[model samples]
Target: MHTVVCIKQVPDSAQIRVHPVTNTIMRQGVPAIVNPYDLYALEEALRLKDRYGGRITVLCMGPPQAEAALRKALSFGADDAILLTDRAFAGADTLATSYALAAAIARIREDMPVDLVFAGKQTIDGDTAQVGPGIATRLGLQLLTYVSAVGEVDPENRRIIVQRRAEGGVQVLETALPCLITVLEGLNEMRFATMADMFRAARHPLTVWDREAAGIEDITKIGLKGSPTVVSKVFAPRPRTTRAELIEAQSGQPNDLADTLLAKLFTKHPQLGRQIVRRSS
Candidate 1:
């Protein structure tokens, strides 16, 4: 199938901290893990590989440290790993990131033609859900996001079918080859890595490419300059000071409990009580 799965190394959310004064992410002491959503994407790619007997390439764009994420993918049985790292790629927003990734994928195409590109619906840190679509737009690939299930892949005919999650229901979509998909979470369970796979991942020669190697000719299209979005400020949400108001039923009866809660709610918000009554009518 010649699938490429895009992944990222993100600070573990549970261990992430915000600077007290600056209110920016405190990444110094936080441990980095592969984005959980991307794991699902990788698992989907692996499933496709198992079915079709094709190569799966794990791709990542981050600092040198992001090779850890690529290694993790290799342990999961990916055929190859590529890390695109450069100082020029620093402070890149989704736009710049997609551009760099599309460029790298183009470089990969020079050797082997890619049939499908996979990515998470969104990164845990960014959560913009834009990069996949951006990459598809830049590469002129068919865009499919929030895919809940993959139906059929006909490489001979160059067509694929997928179940996409929409606002009200699922939409079955059939698209041409060279498509980019952003897979939704909870589609399938991830397989565990075997001992041999672990060892192979440890000894795997990761392909590391800098900006020039990745075929980024325009300096202005990468790094901070390429990113148009800017964060004016970051702040922690204010903690609530008020305590929960407990509704105690004197009788220990379900009806009594409901009555007590309703009384308290009505007392607190008379307008809400009137609205509820009007709706019932």
Candidate 2:
């Protein structure tokens, strides 16, 4: 029951800024943290490890500084950490990222057969929600997205049941082993890292792999070259200038309050009152 969890190091959205001239994100002086959504996926994997007593591997693809993200995962009790970093992987979009990750996971499978893979529903920075599905398709694994709960796992029979959140209602899904799941938020709470685990995480030697080590055969299928998406512009939304209006009821009763509110609303916008009268008629 070996599990692999994918995480990303992203700039804190609250501190993010856009370059006015370049129309790109200004990462300078911004702090980096693990993607919040990925934490849910990691927690789910940790719970599975606790139940099945299997090894858990944390994987990340980013710059060398992204090692901090992997170490954070280690502190949370992951058994192993792997960082995929290379100059050739620069400027990768979701497509290229999934391709590289899929290739690296294949390399990992060579060493130890992976029973399941887990990832977040989406990244805060990109918010595209495409990479997980892309990885699943590349690896020919069962794709499970928006998973709210993992119900049962029969490792002996390679069968697993999960509760998926859909637009209409929750769907109970049963799939075989070697599946990839993109977990939604609030799936489970992350546990606090113990002092011993923190010490171990600081001293653990991470396994870093370049493109060649990650078993990437085609150079044209990774990095910016493989990415077809283009960003035309990046900017902040305009702030609203309108202010809220307060309505006071003299009687301080529920009916009086409602009447006052409706009177004020209709007075401010007569068209609304006309529309209501027409509808009633």
Candidate 3:
């Protein structure tokens, strides 16, 4: 079985700051790391590779610096890494990103057939969660989102089963090979990189593909021209000013404390008490 995992290098959200005047993200000094959610997908793919004894390729689309993200995946035992970077892919929204990724994957398929593709549920910077589904749609692959666990894989039969997370419970789904899965976090723990693997990753010759190399025929379908979504504004939320109120009772007993709390709540908001009474009646 051959698997391809997609990952993105994102600015650390913890250290991200908003520009005061521009009301945009200040990424100049922010540290970049692999998207945390994508790590779960990568680990899952690595686990599959370990069990099935197949090659795993890590794919990423970003600037040249994003090669670091692919190398990180390599350190985790991926067999190969591919970086899709070009000026034409700049300022791409989810649609354009999916288009470019789908094209690149098709190019990869020409060389070696890909049986599975994995991605994170969403990116931290862009929580839209649309790119994976978009890629699946474009590639005509079975789309599986919010996958909690992979249950079984029958390579001979070209069938696979997975546990998908739903609104109230989990759904067990069976699909054919060549499916795309957007995995939820906590699917599996990432393995620690061995010193040998780390050295190998540092020295690995990464496959870098520009637009033409990635088999992008239409220039208009990538980058800013293909992106239709517009960000109206970007700003930080205002800090809340309300403070918590403490209720005290002389008795300091649980029952006394409950009564005191209810009395204070009723006194402070008479409408709440009336609503409770009305609902009970």
Candidate 4:
């Protein structure tokens, strides 16, 4: 079984800087880290590989620097890593991102058929959570999102049982192999790398693919041209106009302040004061 996990490199939220002219995120010089949500997905995939005995592959789509995220996953025990990087892939939204990853999965299938595809619940910068479903839909694979646990896997029967989180409660679902799952967080813990894993990742030759190398035939469908939605504008939030009124007591008496506040509150909203008094009573 070959488990493929989709991960992303994101600008650290604490250091997000917006472009003054375009309002787009100024990712340059921003400390990039693996999407925190993706760590849960990667950890879940690693758990499955540990139980079922197979190789795990980490896949990411971003600039050349995104190789760091892939290398981080490798350090945590992923068997292989692939970075799909290209100028044509810039400014891609969720739809285009799904298309590009789907193409890469197809390319991987040629070598070793992927038994399972995993992705985080969503990206921090782009919390669409649509790409996983889009890939599953395009590839005709079973789609499972918000998975909390893998209850069982019947390799002999080629079927797996999983627990999925829903609005009101959890849903127990059964699906076959070659399924795509967007895992929920808190399901498993990421393991620490041994010295050997760290050394191997430091020297790991990541497979970098350009548009052509990734078998992208339709340039329009992989980048800005293929994205349906556009960010028309981004602006800073406006500050609130109103300020809290301060209650003053001439003699610094707490009871006097409370009485003045009560009078002021009743003057502004008599009904609210009535309700408060009733609740206090």
TM-score result, candidate 2: 0.87
Let me know the TM-score candidate 3 reaches against the reference structure: 0.89
TM-score of each: 0.91, 0.87, 0.89, 0.90
Q: Model 2 off-target regions past 4 Å?
A: 19-24, 236-271, 274-281
Q: Candidate 4 has which clashing residue pairs, if any?
A: none
> Per-prediction RMSD in angstroms?
2.7, 3.9, 3.3, 2.4
Report lDDT (Cα) of residue 80, candidate 1: 94
Name the regions of candidate 3 deviating beyond 4 angstroms.
Answer: 238-264, 275-281
lDDT of 4: 0.90
Stretches of model 4 off by over 4 angstroms after superposition: 17-29, 251-259, 271-281
For candidate 2, what's the RMSD?
A: 3.9
**Per-residue accuracy of model 3 over 1-281 as CA lDDT, tens digit each:** 89999999999999998888777878888999999999999999988888887899889999999999999999998988999999989999999999999999999899899999999999998998899999999999999999999989999999999999999999999999999999999989989999998999999989999999999989999999999987777567876888777777898899999999999879888999999999999
lDDT of each: 0.94, 0.94, 0.93, 0.90
Candidate 4's error at 129, in angstroms? 1.3
> How many clashes in each candidate?
0, 0, 0, 0
lDDT of 1 at 223: 84
